[model samples]
Target: MTSPVPSVDLRLVDLLRHDLTAADFTVPGVEAVVGPTAAAALHREQDVPARRAVAAVLRAVADPAAVLTALWVLGEDVTRRQVDAALPGLGADGAVALGLVEASGQGADDAVRAAVDLRPYAAQDAVGEVTWWLASDLSELQTGRRLAADHVLGAGGASLTLAQVTMRDPRGRVLDLGTGCGIQALHAARHAGSVVATDISRRALAFAAFNAALDQPDAVTALDLREGSMLEPVTGERFDLVVSNPPFVITPRTGAAGGGASGLPDYEYRDGGRAGDDLVRDLVVGLGEVLEPGGVAQLLGNWEHRRGEPWTERVGSWLDAAGLDGWVVQREVLDPAEYAETWLRDGGSTSDRDPAVWADAYGAWLDDFASRDVEAVGFGIVTLRRPDPAAAPAGRVTLRRLEEHTGSVRQPLGAHLAAVLAAHDRLQGLDDDALAAQRLVVAPDVTEERYLTPGAADPNVVLLRQGDGLGRAVHASTSLAALTGASDGELTVGQITGAIAALFDVSATDLAAELLPAVRGLVTDGFLLLPQ
Candidate 1:
């Protein structure tokens, strides 16, 4: 039987916190006990090495950290004495009461096993580095079975990815839609005056509440936990910022191939129970209703790339429908087979373990794709901002930029995003003449590279590369290169372009017209900065 969802017993949770802190069952502490080899192996989802590593530590020393790692993290059975030692404040009985563990027998020799997956998570964002204890349903490694439909996910790669990219600017109110374990809400609480965390799963809300109270009590007090699907709970409200890592995984509809009698595996943590990417589409288009003017929403999503239709057009249409200023950075693309294998393995359906089940699910996935004429799947980070009504354009030029940047980008991109948005707004207010009069400076992170033919004097290519933000590389024309090289906050763009025009024997008007667009692109992308 599936274990009961954990209760939010503040008293017991406080005691558990005290014990956890005392035992130093933190990220660093666990790494120390498991050693680097086991730690690295565990990160790859291999537990044997971590188990052996922790076991060796326990044999040599009766350490609380080792005991906790072996019992909770490694999912190994520990004696009553070990459990008592690890959680002295919250004894074995207290742990069982909180639904964190279960005892098999009354004797000390009897083994006690963890009922949930609890681990320490540490991360650094705009707010700074923070450590928190996160609780969720145990994984296949712990339960030795496939996951339940409504599994509350812990801090996985996607969670951290969304967290790192979230804009941490201060806001009056923030919303965390589809908050799995409340990680995004926790991050939002750092900067948001008030945070509302909502989820479709009641069980997920319980975990979110528990984690919030345990990790951020002050922030949790301001958190409003509501249970509902999508935006139903906060229908009429508006927020300054909204962040979500929604159940955007595209799953097949019922009776479709691989869908089985149950249709798709309705994992509340991933699948939105909607047909073929509709969940993502609906969220993107409907977000405008809940966003206050000038508000911003950041999300991670996957969209289907249908045959003969570009991914940009499909996503761009959503942006146009919403009428919000939007930018999408496609990070990766996977074909139908690769996509099926990934999600299948993610849900613990592997060919080696169950070839027949895998085959059926695989066929269903392919059939679903065939029905939709989907050639591939595209995944990316999407940033949307509601244009401020006061500064709204007469023609309302929506920023519909769809670019691919799969390469490495600077972490904690919140500040960069804010800068880009600010720059865009500033540029919007300036006409060509006004823009030319403004002084400009090259950003510190930008570098220029020139490549020349082996024995030739004149360079054949000039590239301006950004070392931060999206890490963009732009090809620069001779005149534009000269303009950027001289941009030191000391010369107006008009004067620089005039000098370049004279040097190249070109009309100043023609040269400015040619380079103005490139200049605007550089500034918006963080390669150039408008003088303060």
Candidate 2:
């Protein structure tokens, strides 16, 4: 059976919030107790260093923040007396009543274990910096065991990824599908005029409600919480923005993990209970129905890289069916073996703990993939926008970008993506001559690099690099390079191309023909920017 979720009693939550705030249960507060070394280690899933450091601090004196972190954050057993000292306002009894912790023994000297994981979450989104507490099921680090099937997840790497890439433009109505513990909904509430968050798991909804009440007591009208799977709850409703980090993990449907008494995990939070990557595929094609004509959807998903077929073609087909402007950036590709190990460990089925079970599950994953001739699994972020017929005056498919960028990217990519979309619309509305008449300047973050051979006067290759956004670099032809270098917002594209054509002894018409498309691309990618 799954564990209980935290209670949302307003009076008790207010008291708990008061105690937590008084004790300084925050990111920096915990860092102060555990030190930077231990704090960073904990971020990497190494809790030993943090546990030792917290233990050392607890031994020195009575610090409520340290005690709370030890009990809730670290999942360590803390004495009732210590908890009392830490939370003088709420006391240990109030914590137990709120389902935050459970008594592990009988007396005041007895130890208590955290029934739930409560921690501070801080981030920068469209509205600005925000700091609040989030409550969810305990992790493997605290429980020292595998996750339950119906486990409610807290903020993790994938959650942070979707949050970073989500566009922050103020929207009229936003829908956060499969919102686990309401993390994305909180961010959406900051900029959205109205926010609706939905999920399939009742336990997850409970945690979301508790978190919302704790973090956003005054946003009752702005935030709406609902329960149902995918888009079922909000049928026929259209949203301006839809963001989901859904249950997209591909789990084996038979043998080791299919059912009861098999000693295998069937995680409800990650697995949508559908076979392979079909759940993600359905989301890609189905999201269009719930989005407004000009609405946008942001999702993170996994798609199979089948044998003898390109991954882009596989995922692009979904977009074709979607009939929307789409951009899919494949960040990482893992073979069957690598994918098996990565997920198996995530469920706490580690080799050190149960090698036989791990091996069986690994074999099952291989067998399942082999049944379909799957070569690899591609994980990526998907950004899709339903076509606004008005924006494209002429009938045109505006965007269908499918590429990979595995390197570093600037955080809070919302603004950068919004800029790219604006550029796309602007360029789409312009003809070759119209575009040529306009002046463009290089963005401040762009730099040009020229590579040369030893003892050579002229460079062999020219490259224009973008420092942020997708961190893209493009190879520039000599003509294009010259045109870009002269783009100081003083001269129009026609003037620059004419100058380059005259210097190179080429026809200006042919030169503009060759460079117009390239220049438009540069502007779309933010290497060249339209002057404000």
What lDDT does the true structure give each of the candidates? 0.88, 0.88
- State the displacement of the C-alpha of residue 175, model 2, in Å, after optimal TM-score superposition: 1.1
Instruction: Count the clashes in each prediction.
Output: 2, 0
Give model 1's clash tally.
2
Score residue 374 of candidate 1 by CA lDDT: 96
TM-score for candidate 2 = 0.96
Tens digits of lDDT, candidate 1, 1-532: 4567778888998999999999999999999998899888888998998888888888898899999888878788999998988889998989899988889987987889998898999987766788989998998877677787888889998898889888887899999999988999999999989999999999998889989888887667999999999999999999999999999887766543334653335688998888888989999999999999889999999999999999999999999999999999999999999998889888877523766777777888888889999999999999998888677755374577999888998877778888998898888888899989989999999999999999999889999999988788999998899999999999999999999999989899999999999999998888889977
Write candidate 2's Cα lDDT for 1-532 as tens digits. Answer: 5688888788888888888899999999999999999999988999999989988988898888899899889988899998888888778888888899999766789998899999998876545678899999998888777788889999998998888889998899999999999999988888889999999988898898888888988774578888898899999999999999999988888978544355466787898988899999999999999988889999999999999999999999999998889999999999999998899888877724777777788888999899889999999999999988788644345899999888888877878888899998888778998999889998889888999999999899999999989899999999999988888999999999999999999999999989999998999999998877
State the lDDT at 202 in candidate 1. Answer: 90
For residue 191, give model 1's deviation from the true position in Å. Answer: 0.6
Over the full model, what C-alpha lDDT does candidate 2 score relative to the true structure? 0.88
* Candidate 1 wrongly placed segments (more than 4 Å): 255-264, 394-397
The deviation in Å at residue 254 for candidate 2 is: 1.0
